[model samples]
Target: MTHLTLALDAMGGDVGPCVTVPAALQALASNPGLHLLLVGDPAALHPLLAKVDSALLSRLEIVPAESVIASDARPSQAIRASRGTSMRIALELIKTGRAQACVSAGNTGALIGLAKLLLKPLEGIDRPALVTVLPHQQQGKTVVLDLGANVECDSAQLVQFAVMGSVMAEEVLSLRNPRVALLNIGEEETKGLAAIRDAAAQLKNTPSINYIGYLEGNELLTGKTDVMVCDGFVGNVTLKTMEGVVRMFLSLLKSSSTDVGRKAKQAWWLTLIGRFIQRRLAKRFGHLNPDQYNGACLLGLRGTVIKSHGAANQRAFAVAIEQAMQAVQRQLPDRIAARLKTVLPKSD
Candidate 1:
């Protein structure tokens, strides 16, 4: 029997339980074996469910949690100060073995801090990473790791991320011998800072991963590299910038017409060509839609903590729930743990 149970932080996002309640229903429709324990004020959730269809309401279980963490609260302070906050309670469900994974579209820092403190990292792993998927030119998507987890890392950590990310691509996406690359300024060996150089050397030496040497930032969308590894700082900036650029391009394409009367004439032409092209590109290479990859598996944690965008819409929220179900069914955390042991720097 598949013991798939999910703990959701119902009060974390902007829309709160209102959006989350409906999303839970959508997830249930898509995945029958899935079970959910919603952690938040029961009073708030009852009304939300009342608004939802009866079919979905039957699949949910509301676990009342009084305390709530404000978006601006510091992760450490909030987790410690409010024991009953939805985020903390959701973590407890995983720790207590009531749920296989926890999902929160709330504060990023709070989620990271709570995960590290509650679950701890696997042996020999120094830091956990947040990874996401991006469209590849080869008709699919590639996984990018450490998008915003450990900003500073040693050579060993970088090599480990390569191994972890590669396994994810292979196991999750079914890619064979997924090509791994160290994100660098240039493809050349001697192009980046000392940190990048040393990290590249370590990845090349690592036996478990198929390290394909340095990859420039532009190569990420080319589908040439299956997994791109970088420090959290660089990865976060790159992910956001790529998302921003895609959005800006779409905006310009939509409003290409300038004049009032002439605008109507040009709008039709732009709609027929430019608009069509922009929509396709955005679907393939853009990041404005959080629903594209709803939840980020907090890799390296003892248990899974799937993080979602705090402002996630219903679609994005549903994606997060679906991702949680997938991770549990696939044993992603256990797979990552076993894989990491192979490449962990052996103690003398």
Candidate 2:
């Protein structure tokens, strides 16, 4: 509900304006002080907003975009042709102080390339990371980084991720001395790749970091570690796999609910109890819904930029907008920059 402004790449995602328009309207309705700049092709976006209340429409503006970057386009190629595109214009809004933050469910690689070039990396940081919190079984959250940014990272780059992830956990998640761990094949000291082992060694010696040793894939949601670090290839696969499992589980739940409704049609009391149980189950597993965690904050940039899943639905895209809102409110980049001074080695 804070007085926040954001730019949305309305023509970026798979469903484009159909999803973004509804999400934007939902966000505006919830936050009275929020203003949004929707960047996309005006001809496509105008019809979507045709029926919105004039007063609400006053807080929203459409910045015409001439083109769009294909979801499968290479990052390098997209940058060359990025001018006037919805995603690029959204980033430009942030760079020019027209918006506090930007959210895009566009091509991940293109978004990263454009953001790093426009926003620039923070001082002492070279490789920016994609960070987002994952809900644990015990209701605690863990900050994981390098979601899909750098596929193959060296020891030094991994260490940088550790530092950034640690700062993210502490400053953004409000946790103290967040336990940091490298995602590996095993928990032993000598397990996994040389780069990961070396990063673990460096983190162990760094007094500023609370290195808790290596974390295996199965232990990610155990609530044992506060920050999980891994290369983008592994991180991306892990995140997608987990999201797929969650979606599968939720789909099964829905199917079961429908079957129950059909069987209880003749018995009103049975139907009533079934609905009650279904509601309870939904509320219990609501936090685990993959849609709620669709947005991944692209950390280490000078300004806030959130990368939503390309296939994100209306609810998922709305969640991404809210993530951008929080990142801007918390001033995540400035805080991470300040913390880097203490954690980053001086020789670099």
Candidate 3:
């Protein structure tokens, strides 16, 4: 896309500048048209960039901040004490039109609270949802929403999530008329909670959504549908569980290959076969790595904000930055607003 600037809360994550600064440098190197405003204490940020190449430095600037939001702080507390904080500064930059979006690995509650207060939700959206992209059974992608944004949601909010997720899938993944589904206990119409069943009825009546009934936990990666909508409590637990399982499986594949290789060293035939199987397994499931999909966007707001994993390493943080760039390039907020205008429920 064209030249775009993004504000990054450099002091928000676990290691703060240690992770974000290098990630910023790496992102600048990869995307020549991108500029970054690193918001944090200069004392903490300058040293990290001191040895960097001057060309990269030209496109990056450091915006000074006096404080940072504690990772474990309550949302209300963080917001009340947010003045001069790195996260607040980064967000303010967006509100003032100096940046297209903000990316932070900061306190989740604080980020959501500040973003909603500053950027404001889209006119028809009751609340913004945290939506993420995941790889499907095939080469396609599936999008899930409310990944820890709102722990509890009403029927109206659930239907709103479906709309937000559908718009995001189209805008970010380039999908056409994407199939949407509710993450539920079972596929049967009468299976889930009252809110879920009510949302199901609402989705069924909305012709624009292309609602496709329910998706069980096991069916998430099956590519059965393009969008999975759920309240935050279930979605967050489900996402963490999926990540842990995928990691365990990938670890087992590697360990199996090593064990087989050691035991088969005396037999050339066995060694050759073991190597082939290892390569096949790795090729088949390598893309399932969770780090590659670490960034989750808070959708349905007036401006874009990408939430990177607080413990994300350099490569993962760069991926978050790239996601923000894509959202900005595609005008994500505007697209969702336009979609909501047409489909927002008349009441509720």
- TM-score to native of every candidate shown: 0.89, 0.95, 0.95
- lDDT tens readout by residue for model 1, 75-188: 678767868889989998999999999999888888888888888887767778898777776777788989888888777778778877987898778889899998989988
Candidate 3 deviant stretches above 4 angstroms:
265-280, 346-348
Range of the 10 consecutive residues with the lowest summed lDDT in candidate 2: 257-266
Candidate 3 local lDDT, 69-97, one digit each (tens)? 99999999999999999999999999999
Evaluation by lDDT, superior candidate among 1 and 2: 2
The segments of candidate 2 whose C-alpha lies over 4 angstroms from its true place after superposition are 260-266, 346-348
lDDT of 2 by residue, 161-209 (tens): 8888888888778999999999999988879999998988888889988
Q: Count the backbone clashes (under 3 Å) in each candidate.
A: 0, 0, 0
For candidate 1, give the lDDT of residue 301: 77
Error of 3 at 127 (Å): 1.3
Candidate 3 Cα RMSD (Å): 1.8
lDDT scores in order: 0.81, 0.90, 0.93
Candidate 3 is scored at a TM of 0.95
Candidates in descending lDDT order: 3, 2, 1
